[model samples]
Target chain A: MSQFENVSVVKQANVYFDGKCISHSVQFADGTKKSVGVVLPATLTFNTGVPETMECVAGACRYKLKDGDWQSSRAGESFSIPGNSSFDIEVVGEPYHYVCHFG
Target chain B: MSQFENVSVVKQANVYFDGKCISHSVQFADGTKKSVGVVLPATLTFNTGVPETMECVAGACRYKLKDGDWQSSRAGESFSIPGNSSFDIEVVGEPYHYVCHFG
Candidate 1:
């Protein structure tokens, strides 16, 4: 069996969503597997005024809304929108990394 | 509606497991809700020799397996075990934190 098949289902990794988010999975050296979705800076926005949300899968990030209001989020933080809100977000300083899933 | 009812189902948070791990959920300031499982050092062990695992929901941690061999895990990392393995983990320095669910 592949590494994924050996381990019991301990937990599912977190997922984040953006227009250009990419999905991928990895198996650690100790036979653990993590599946994740990633959104980069270039593809962080959508044309419609949809709310973008993410859960910190592994790091910290600073985010902002319409003007320049900022907020910091760490792993396990989750957010969402109702499909008719306007928002913009960027990684605080380094690359913005999170696992995401969208509707 | 409560904040949990307002946000769309963005993504489910990760879960970790140890025998005495406790489960809890929280809603953040921006109307975001985060559900997490906490395993403090006191109740972190089991008598049946089951494997203990955690996903770094927010910060960083250093862990050791059988004999003080150390490994560092950041957020997004996931691990699991069959019903018969043995292991031990610590938060490195600060309090250990993670969101978890179990079967």
Candidate 2:
């Protein structure tokens, strides 16, 4: 069996976003990496009016919806965004680390 | 939302296991608690000959199988145990935190 066959631990890494926070990449811990960029950070919102799923691993943030409703999340919190909509967010403190999976 | 809606963060709590090392409980973070004890820790082993699923949240431990092959796990690691078997474990460091779900 592979070294990871019985392992479920995934390490976290940092990414550099240049003003535009939209990009995608397949990160592997085994020294191999793949790049896939087709989304925009500004256009990719969640928990407010965006169609996406976001999980917060650290820090906090506020998501403002198009209809004026807002949601807040802190470290260890997760939120689900409905499809066919968009939203905005402001980092509450420090740089936030989130995992976003989109369709 | 009932404060738990849209939140995926689960807080960890300490469990006091007697020398027997076997107990069951449904732990909730919302001030509610449930207790279920029907399994023996000595008979509920994993990754070796135990048919149980185990997750390591903190510290490290080693599982020595009956066949002499052993498995080790550190913090943040998780492993699945096959069904109908049992194994033994030895904590390597400080008290370890693990979550076991059985059928």
Candidate 3:
């Protein structure tokens, strides 16, 4: 869906990479937490504490997992990153919009 | 409150001024709309279509409404702008986080 319904959204944003990446936390009634975020034109490395699935909502990105080749993810696509791993994401031209689901 | 509960939030963000300002739209069941956003350290001008109340969630900014003196809004504080008017906001050091209430 284009939007999440019946959820709780935190007012403050989580800024990363000196504002190149910004996200707002969203909490579900069932205790599941997600984040809607955007990555502006930049290449950044991110480490994940928990297993995460990055679902692309708009724009596009090329991401690489540890020891893996870079792969593209566009709108309506998703990529998974294992817990305790790091990934590098590259965005250019347009900002990459995503919904990050955590487990 | 620090968060909005039982609301719908769009997945994508509204990027303005080449990503200097970013916001996500939140919808209430009552059909009211608000935005949770952050502005990176920069000076920017914004024009409002509807009256808006910008509630600071974190950081701070100095703002000047049309024909008004510059004023500061910090965390836990708020400032308002009239509809069809413009305002200048200056943020330094840190990104200014806000929840924008519309009327």
Judging by DockQ against the true structure, name the best candidate.
3
**Which candidate would rank higher by DockQ, 2 or 3?**
3
Better of 1 and 3 by lDDT: 3
Regions of candidate 1 where Cα sits further than 4 Å from its true position? A1-21, A24-35, A40-44, A47-52, A92-94, A101-103, B1-103
Indicate which candidate wins on lDDT: 3
Over B1-103, each residue of candidate 2 has an lDDT whose tens digit, in order, gives 1011111222111122222232223334443432221111232343333355566644567776556577787666766656665566766424344555453
What are the per-candidate TM-scores when only chain A is compared? 0.44, 0.53, 0.99
lDDT (Cα) of model 3: 0.98
Q: Write down the worst ten-residue block by lDDT for model 3 chain B.
A: B94-103
Ranking by DockQ: 3, 1, 2
True contacts kept of 3: 0.96
Candidate 2 chain A has its poorest 10 consecutive residues by lDDT at A1-10
Q: Mind giving the per-residue lDDT tens digits that candidate 3 earns over B1-103?
A: 8899999999999999989999999999999999999999999999999999999999999999999999999999999999999999999999999999998
Task: Candidate 2: list runs displaced more than 4 Å.
Answer: A1-24, A27-50, B1-103
The number of the candidate with the highest TM-score is 3
lDDT at A49 for candidate 1?
38
